[model samples]
Target: MAITSIFNDAFVLTWDFILTIVDAVTPSHPAGHVVPAGHPGAGGEWPEYVSPGEGDSRCACPMLNAMANHGILPHDGKNISFKTMNETIRSTYNFSPSFCYFVPNYIARALDKDYFKDTFDLEQISVRNDKGIEHDASLTREDVRFQPDQGKPHIPFINELLATASGKDTSAEDPENALMLTSDDLARYSAKRRTDLENIGGKLDFIHKMFGSSNSATLLRIVGGHVSDLRPFLIDERIPDKWEPAIRSRVGLTMARFNLTVLPLEFSTRKHMKALAKAKKSG
Candidate 1:
């Protein structure tokens, strides 16, 4: 069964999914800031030894596609072992993005927890700070970690095998499938983009301000500003004059009620349902 199907049900809200998300977003850099660099074409000759085209491939990782081709990764996307998977990934590239480190681990844990019915005990460790006071940090067999290399950057490798297997495209571009969006499509995309930014900025800016400053907030501000630039192009007399503010207000209301405004509605609802289920079970 697909990982999504396993976790999609309200009754199936396992800790595995939440833990995987946590592991995925965790900083992989040695300094715990900035995503390490590596794009698709830099690492290896992914889909048969060839050269990168005019621009970088928009695909996630060629190495991952190569893994799927070689049968080192499971065809069914289940029954993965982190030790085995990590060794393969490490051997493939000398260095990669921090986010790439734990994705396979996350997939392995998700598959084990949901389909294979495996269990693990969290281990505790103590470490002393500069003040010489000790704090506890939980340890696990599976974890997110950084593999740093001061070299060329690459694209973050996503766990595509966990989702579905697709035919490896050796060519740089899939000519048959490469149709750019039209002007109207761009307009709609821009409108949606503007609304999303305003929502995210209005809701999170206050909290981010409270915490002083963060890379996350800075990035949001940058992206939000860019989206704001596209506002006039995307909206006009056809759209409501108050459309932007109204959308932001709706986002704030949703955030206040549910503590989420950025995620897609289906995903947010499912996440909330899962959290409620977890709370009820613990209570």
Candidate 2:
């Protein structure tokens, strides 16, 4: 396992170096036009939801899948260019222009594709290698050890996540109700998932753990901070009706802002997991 991890790290580093060179030489694509929120071209109202059918490509990432389902991305999930992905994500989610580019660049490096010329199919992002972007102990998908097909949602796990909000103050009458998962709630849940995977001999490495943490933070920040809003997005891979971008800013969410949210959550999750393991050992 140690040797494999080392190899994976080296491979990832090499890919990153290669991509840096390619990106340096590649001319930037013109910024795609942004449609106004709530307009026909924007993800707000007009685009009808369509379920992915036979031969349609899908991926392990729920957000991307949901985008494809909502027609914010190609319904067929094929031949997606970085420029298209960047514009769509920015317009739909209100992510910063830099963040929009950052994600596609990361995906390109992870999937070993050229960021400039090569278009990617969604299924290409589902590579199960340990160093790849897709990892085990996902919030809504079973680990690859148990289910090779990680592209589909795991209903049981989604149910477990929703259960965290069950007893909270979800009163519809109160506008400022506490129906959402707090940072601690999300951290505890993430710790539990990590522990469960470890007990089953499916421990995640540092890269995978960081990826999981980023996913959680993205859910908390980008997706509606409420668990109720997350339900359809996770279970059905559908964007909720009347959904609006949670964070609205001209600059949008930058890498620094995202890391500020993720780092503390990751630390808290690790601390909780350590406590759980210590308690188990003492018992």
Considering every candidate listed, which one attains the maximal lDDT? Answer: 2
Q: Which residue pairs collide, candidate 1? A: 37-153, 37-154, 38-153, 38-154, 38-155, 39-154, 39-155
Model 1 over residues 51-84: C-alpha lDDT tens digits?
2223222111223323433343442223445554
Across 1-21, the per-residue lDDT of candidate 2 in tens digits comes to 357546755664565455445
- The 10 consecutive residues of candidate 2 with the worst lDDT sum are 26-35
Which pairs of residues have clashing backbones in candidate 2? none
Estimated TM-score per prediction? 0.21, 0.81
- The residue ranges of model 1 lying beyond 4 angstroms of the native Cα positions read 1-66, 75-78, 93-101, 108-283
Give candidates' CA RMSD values in order.
21.5, 7.5
Clashes of 1: 7
Q: Number of clashes in every candidate structure?
A: 7, 0
